[model samples]
Target: MPDTRSGDRQMAPPRPRPKRSDAEDNRARIIDIARTAFAAAPDATLQSIAKAAGVGQGTMYRHFPSREALLLAVYRTDVEALVEVAPSLLDAHEPLDALRLWFGRLAAYGRIKHGASQAMEAATRADLKSQYYPPVVAALDQLLTACKDAGHLRPGADADEVLLLVSFLWRAESGPDWQERTDRMLGIVVDGLRTAPRA
Candidate 1:
């Protein structure tokens, strides 16, 4: 006679992992494609992005929901790429130089994002509020801390102020000469950051 023990229990089948929605997957794909196009050519159009992504216009729309949405994603992707390189910059270069390198990268990123700001600005005012500024700011803060620790920057220089200066330089200068200008401006900024005792 088979007697079931009180402790005996049939194991239930393992629960299946929930699948990601097609919309989520497609959204990610669209962002990847958009980033490729934006990187390859900053002025890439939506049609071009759709072609590069191997998705029809409707598919792109279904995923991104709007051009502004796609543009924000593209901007965020570019910023993310720059931010991801920060740790390596710190490791590979001196503390002060690492900050300079990151600032240079921000300038380049701004150049790539030249015309996209209008769309991004509009999106920023909307409910989306996903313009990727926080990551950029955080990256700047990391670089600033490194510089400060190395005594290469002024003790009280605010990260926001530095970012604003960089943004201003990026907006005013838009030519091949901009690189040299950026370097010079960076030098001035760095010098101002140097620890100076109160007069």
Candidate 2:
């Protein structure tokens, strides 16, 4: 029986620890580089992004296997930023005012993301659905629920429908008349929602 208990169990192999912060930082750098390239030229290719980012093309490939993957990454970053800041909007001077404020930001996000999406499509990727849609939609649903609960929005109005309308309108081309036209459209929408039957 001498040392029998100790011999019974074999030693387990060491597990690899994840480099959470380093991986996060590298991801951040890649996204920042991609964003800078896109801002300068929305059609920047992977090679261009690699050159701008000071990383090798292989590195970029490692981080984002395909152009669509990069596009999805960028879109997710923007949505994360939007979703992260949403809570502060809840403390606005008024609930409707907060809704309007967030909607404006959402419109701006729509414009930026649309530009990125066009680039991704041109990159020859087939998948059109964003990888970030589910989370973003869920976050917006929360906001919509808050407004409905407060009786500031139409009870039966679908948040998804409203989001689609805003996204569609946000794509209207920019011009001297565009801002005013958009404002009028948004105003009409708000009015319609506010006046609709609560139940």
Candidate 3:
């Protein structure tokens, strides 16, 4: 009986330690600075970003480990934010309005992606797209389905096709008037997706 009881007992797995508050703050600061630095200059050095962030090189390295790591973190943060806001937008507004608001966020993310892509290698860019594309499409689908259910959008509005139609976001030249141009283009696309009223 003693032998059987001993064998039945098992050790619990060790819990991972939470990051210290200061470390979390430093990491967040570094990413915030890196996003601006990279956007302004695609080849901005890690040392400069650390300095701009007011963190030492050692702290930056501990958090990001490499330039590519920092870039990915920034892009991933943007994507997560973009996806996370969809539900809240839908909760706060009508379905079509929520979709339009989400597109505005997507346009902002496209700007960040345009700049970050210049610094990433071809394989790295491909990997980012694969990892991020699904969640983005899913978020869009959520909004689109809500719109269709509410009869605010055409019944056949497919998320994938809608995303494809908006692909010009990243392709359009980011000049001084880029925001205005993209906004106009997005409005056109949204209008096209709207359900036509019965005569």
Better lDDT candidate (1, 2): 1
Ranked candidates, highest lDDT first: 3, 1, 2
Stretches of candidate 2 above 4 Å error? 1-8, 54-58, 80-88, 91-94, 122-135, 174-188, 195-199
Per-residue lDDT of model 1, residues 132-180, tens digit only: 5666677778888888888777777777787877776547536668778
RMSD of 2: 4.6
Question: What C-alpha lDDT does candidate 3 achieve relative to the native structure?
Answer: 0.86
Superposed model 1: Cα runs more than 4 Å off: 1-44, 52-59, 82-84, 127-135, 196-199
* TM value for model 3: 0.87
lDDT of 2: 0.70
TM of each candidate vs. truth = 0.66, 0.68, 0.87
Error of 2 at 138 (Å): 3.3
**Candidate 3: residue 140 Cα off by (Å):** 0.3
Cα lDDT, model 1, residue 140: 78
